[model samples]
Target: MIRVLVVDDDPLVCAHLEAVFGFADDIEVVGEAYDGAAALESVLRHRPDVVLLDLRMPGIDGLAAIPRIRAVDPPPAIVALTTFDSDHHIVRALHAGASGFLLKTTPPRELIALVRVAADGHTVLSPTVSRRLIETAADRHVTRGETLARLAALTPRETDIVACLGGGMSNARIAARIHLSEGTVKNHISQILAKLHCTNRTQAGLLAQRAGLRPPRPAG
Candidate 1:
């Protein structure tokens, strides 16, 4: 089962998320926290596979708690929660090691699927968010040359995999497009992350985007 921790200052939101996960046989709600400080504590106690974390809280907000939670041995994947897709906090959270961000208004089914994706060590960016993040990187003036240098360590195959990541393609889709097995794609992703010095796929994807990498065309 994929263990999940729901963290939000609002009790209703936490309960709602718990109920949503209840319907997914593959997912379990392991714990809940009302604030970031408690989130850190709960993460240590429950050791969840994925954490749905609210960005704003009474104390030690999600932004501050993300890096702390991620510092734990074998940290869980963290997906930030926000009311607005354009929230600046999401970008900071991503840089702080969050796997991705999800709008609070996401449908229950999509939320469940995203949690499962996070548990599987994949990113959870919606196309809108992905485009905004790429724009954010561009706004920061992360020149293509700089990103290219960072990706220089990758082999041609790894480059293609990272490009798939840039397009937010899951392992299955990437495998089909690249004519590789899902297991092989997963392995390539791992190597890609290590070579790029990225803690998660979100970072690698952003790097790929900054470098203007495009996914390989589908095979005829």
Candidate 2:
């Protein structure tokens, strides 16, 4: 079972998240906090497997809370909660040890899925805001050498796959581009994620972009 701690200053948001978790048999809301300071206390007491954290919490705030939470022994995975995808706090949260960044307005089902995915050490960063995080990071400059080194560990074929992922291509599109089966692409992605020690594609893509893994062919 996945034990979740919902941390947001708004009680209604906390209630809604707890209600959403109620739909899943495998997840349980173990605790709720209205601020990062309170969240930290709850986290130490509950030791939840995942934390749905609001970025703008009072006191410590989500961005400041991440590393603190991570410092706990066997820290739970953290997913930053924001009202919008492009919120600048997302990157700060991610860099601070958050496993995922999710919008508060995400569909109920998807929000539940995000919790599960984060619990399992996987993420749906393949699309949307997650993709934008990496794309923007690439356009600017983040850690490059680390990403290049990680990508270099892949075989030529896997390197091809990583490039596609970094370019924000879906598994289906990558399969079409490389003439490989989608299942094969999935396997490659799995390997890439494992090798990079990244929880999700957004992290991997940003790393790839930092490494300067550009698409091999011109886009039509």
Candidate 3:
């Protein structure tokens, strides 16, 4: 079962998440925390597969707590839950080690699916939030020349995989798009991780975005 810990200052949101996961056969709500301080304690105790974290909360908000949670030995995938898709907060959260970002208005089913996808080592972003991130990244100063220099070690195919990762496609989707078997895709991802020195797929995705590597458009 996929263990999940819900962290939000609002009790109603916590209860709602609990109820939603209670109905899912593959997921179990392991614990709940009212704020970031409580969230740290709960994470230490639960060691859940994923954490649904609220960005704005009373004392030690999600943004401040993310890196600490990630320092835990077996850190769980953290998905930031926010009401707004503010570029500032989104970039901060991702840099602080959040694997996914979702609006609070996301439907329950989609939220569950996102958590699953994140726990499976894929980067998940609400579509609008993703667009904002891309726009924000485009305005940043990560020069293509510098990015290419940093990625000079990658093979051409590995670079292609990185672009797909930047687009937030999962291994199965990348496999289908590149006409490779899923196992081959997984092997390529492993090599990409080593080449980029990224600890996880989320980091690789962020690097690719910062490097301005856009995946090719699908042929109609």
Candidate 4:
């Protein structure tokens, strides 16, 4: 089972998320927290596989809590929850080691799928949000030259994988696109993360985007 912890200041939102997960046989709601401090505690106590974390809270907001939660040994995957797709906190959260961010208005079914994606060690960025994040990075002066310098450490094959990651392709999808087995793709991704010094796929994806990399076009 994929254990999940729901964190939101609003009780209703927490309950609603719990109920949504109740229908997924593969997912279990392990705990809930109303603030960042409690979130850290719950993470230690429950050791969830995924955390649906609200960005805004009374204290120790999600932004502040993300790094702390991620610092735990064998940290869980964290997906930030936000009301707006354009929320600036989303970018910061990703940099701080979140797997991705999900809009609060996401359909229950999609939410469940995204949590599964995160648990599988893949990023969960929607295409639109991905574009915005890339743009935001550029606006913040994350130049292609700098990003490319970092990407230079990767092999050509790993660079292709990073480009696929930039497009938010899951391991299975990347495998199909690159004509490799899923296991090979997963192993390459692990190597990519280590070489890029990224904590997760989301960070790698963003760096790939900042470098303006794209997946190769399909062969004729």
Model 2 has how many clashing residue pairs? 0
* TM-score, per-candidate, Cα-based: 0.88, 0.70, 0.85, 0.90
How do the residues 115-167 of candidate 3 rate in per-residue lDDT, one tens digit apiece?
88888977788765757574464325667677678788988888888889888
Q: Give the per-residue lDDT of model 1 (tens digit) for 1-220.
A: 9999999999999999988989999999999999999999999999999999998898899989999999989999999987867636666888789998888888888888888888988878654465655546432656788889989999999999999888888899999999999999989988998988887888888788778899999988
Report lDDT (CA) for all predictions: 0.86, 0.77, 0.84, 0.87
Return the candidate ranking by TM-score, descending. 4, 1, 3, 2
Best by lDDT: 4
Model 3: CA > 4 A from native: 128-130, 179-184, 194-199, 216-220
On a 0 to 100 scale, what is the lDDT of residue 210 in model 4?
A: 80
Off by over 4 Å in 1: 126-130, 133-139
Per-residue lDDT over 1-220 for candidate 2, one digit per residue giving the tens place of the 0 to 100 score: 9999999988998899888989999999999998888888999999999998888866788888888888888878888887867636656666677877787778888877778878875444413475546456443443566557667878888887777766767777788888889898889888887987765565676676667687567446
Model 4 poorest ten-residue lDDT run = 130-139
Point out the worst 10-residue segment of candidate 1 by lDDT: 130-139
lDDT of 3 at 37: 91
TM-score of 3: 0.85
**Candidate 2 lDDT:** 0.77
Worst 10 residues of 3 by lDDT: 132-141
